[model samples]
Target: AEAYPKVKRNSKFKVLDAADIDFFRSILSSDELVESRSPEELASFNQDWMKKYRGQSNLVLLPNSTEKVSKIMKYCNDNKLAVVPQGGNTDLVGASVPVFDEIILSLKNMNRIRDFDSVSGTFKCDAGVVMRDAHKFLHDHDHIFPLDLPSRNNCHVGGVVSTNAGGLNLLRYGSLHGNVLGLEVVLPNGEIISSINALRKDNTGYDLKQLFIGAEGTIGIITGVSILAAAKPKALNAIFCGIDNFDTVQDLFVKAKGELSEILSAFEFMDRGSIECTIDYLKGLPFPLENHHNFYVLIETSGSNKRHDDEKLSAFLSSALDAKLLSEGVMAKDKADYDRIWTWRKSVPPACNSYGGMYKYDMSLQLKDLYSVSEAVTKRLNEAGLIGDAPKPIVKSVGYGHVGDGNIHLNIAVREFTKEIENLLEPFVYEYIASKKGSISAEHGVGFHKRGHLHYSRSDIEIRFMKDVKRHYDPNGILNPYKYI
Candidate 1:
């Protein structure tokens, strides 16, 4: 894997010592403290999910309650010790892991469902609650969390809110900015700020809670969340299609929206390269369609009535087929079929890494130019003689992502991670997005991986404003140093 990017440690922060550990132990139980003296014990906490970044932290604190988190923050701030607040450690961009010797403030122990109002669809929970567990709680109450991700089983609710994650269902339920009612956060100096209300319409001053959403924990650590849950659909169906090209994919999407309308929940895109890699990784798994095409699309619908949803989907498929928009297609007729179809879509990322290493870029671009960047990068790699059989640096570059939100995930699988390959992609990818007036990051936050590349997406004034906000809330820069803006 590629080496962790080099960044100078901030001189203002203090190194961990016995006194610090003793102070933490005073407020927390023995189970809550993990003295990272053993490399094996801290391996998972220090390294990121992608195995691309690593840190050498000496201490990890797990607080079960907001009050305990407040106490730990107060002590760390008083001693000028930098801290990295971690949750689940499932962040693809290295946002949840420490960059250096910064102490890790993990919230894994805080996984608790605080309250739920079935009538109003308002659910409250501790920030460390696993998303899948929260979703199960809501599901039993005939409601569902507004967000859905493949990593739901492992990702923490607080991490999703902090990153402002946009997942498969974003096309339907909307973003956390619109669904989250309130957040309870702990400020840098250990002050508790609670706005965890269940009000749907509160025209309050400034909507201050929004600042922490998508802030990536640079300003404060989110401890509790109150969000408006959506009612679970009684009937759901999915369809996978093979399209002739990107143009037909767009046409099919517009048609699906017009025909499927209210019941449509997700629209995902996968290029041929992505499909091929996924199939290769699956090892002898049959393709969904009779023949392979240049591109594929997955469309899902959810509704209250099974008959109505089935009719709508059937009619939409008939119309699309009549228009010659799809080369071939398969619709889920049973729950097993639905699950199998989603597996095909979700398996694309892991498949990209089958080659050994993968460089992933999540971006937001206009639908018209969504796949162009991937094509260009592939061409660039080919021109540099990096793509080929054995001994070649790159195996393939694939493109796929959520079509509803104008997001695209470009993955380049290589024999191994190398500086030359990274250098070839960095500014080129960022500049391409900037030229298209697109965001360098669509859903992923500008964590340590993308921190230096913020200028490619944000104007100087906007970056200055972000830095100003960071300094205003965390003057000591002790919270999540060397991350975000």
Candidate 2:
């Protein structure tokens, strides 16, 4: 297991014992309980998808219903045992997995679709339902979930909701905070509080559901979700274009928003370093362009009229080319090509990791200065003699993300995970983000990884209020202890 030297297990939280296991076995079926005796089965539950953060959890409970979850939480709270609420276990930050001997409460068994109102375009489902499954279900009904991401197949709706993941379709559908209507969350003390409703407008007191949307399960475990869905677009088109520089990328984005307007679904940006790393990792995947450029942009449009969308996209591309904003471009010929083009953008993170390790920072900066951070980081690492060919700890610093949202994913791919490399990035990256008056974490929640660095993005008063909220919800700090404020 990887060690988090800065954090120690809270003495207030009790260690798991035979009595707790027996109590859990009585409430849950044999299949739902996974004890550490079968380490093989518990392995995946303890490690994160990135394989960078790991836990030494001794037991895992897979509750099939909210009632079962409530019972387990009540007992754990009374016993002062810490618990980690997990779904899909696909979180990049160290939030989903336990840092120490905390018990794992996996939501995999709660996979169920409660209801869907086609007329209202509202969907209600258990938190454990996979995102891909939800998308497929909505597609059949001529409706679509407002959220879309590269990890749709593996990530659960609950996981995405908990992380408040801003994905590829965020430009079109906005964020989960706006799309999600309500939630059924299990508070740390085992109380199941529900704000689940299909109505779009309800100005009754506080919208408590919003708290759990990106809480990372620190105060509660989300068992069900009620979210707004959009009508499936009748037509969809995607284009991959190469740009000469970041300025051109910004100009093209403005042009896309003005020309494509309502039809524009996504505008993603990738720098030369990102493209080179992807190329090296993919190793001849037949890139979209005949030649490489300093930057790449993937644009997509979705609307009810195919002819109108095509004409708008065509006109936009022509003007962009004439203005020299785009050096080269290619429109996806079909669905297969569309998926292939998206792969080039989505495969960046894992591709960078293929070399060895990746130090990822999901940051939000001013549009004009978005790409500058990548350039500055690359130059800094290169000057430090840490980034280069082989035999060096650092491989390269690459940047790519949803430029329309002003979110940039700065990745420092390295030969291995070393303290020295992290030391070089840490306070430096956070401080830079602070200086820009940007968020240290754009979409990814402040997990165990960024818990201590909240000051970079939040003021002392804001953090104090957050801590107060945590205390009001989980007074014992039993829910996801030693993390998140």
TM-score of each model, paired residue for residue = 0.98, 0.98
- Write the residue-wise lDDT of candidate 1 on 1-485 in tens digits: 34554778888789888888888888989989898658878988998877888888988899999999999888888999999999888888888888889999998999999999989999999999999999999999999999998788889999999999999999999999999999999999999998897499888678899999999999999999999999999999999999988988988989988889999999999999999899988888777788888999999999999999998898888788888998888889899889888988988988887788789999999999999999989998888888888899898999999999999999998888887888889889999999999999999888988978888889999999999999999989999988866
RMSD list, candidates in order: 1.1, 1.1
Q: Which portions of model 2 miss their true places by more than 4 Å?
A: none
Q: Give a tens-digit lDDT track for model 2, residues 41-129.
A: 68899998877888889999999999999999999989999999999888878899988889999999999999999988889999999
TM-score for candidate 2: 0.98
lDDT of 2 at 414: 84
lDDT of each: 0.90, 0.90
Best by lDDT: 1
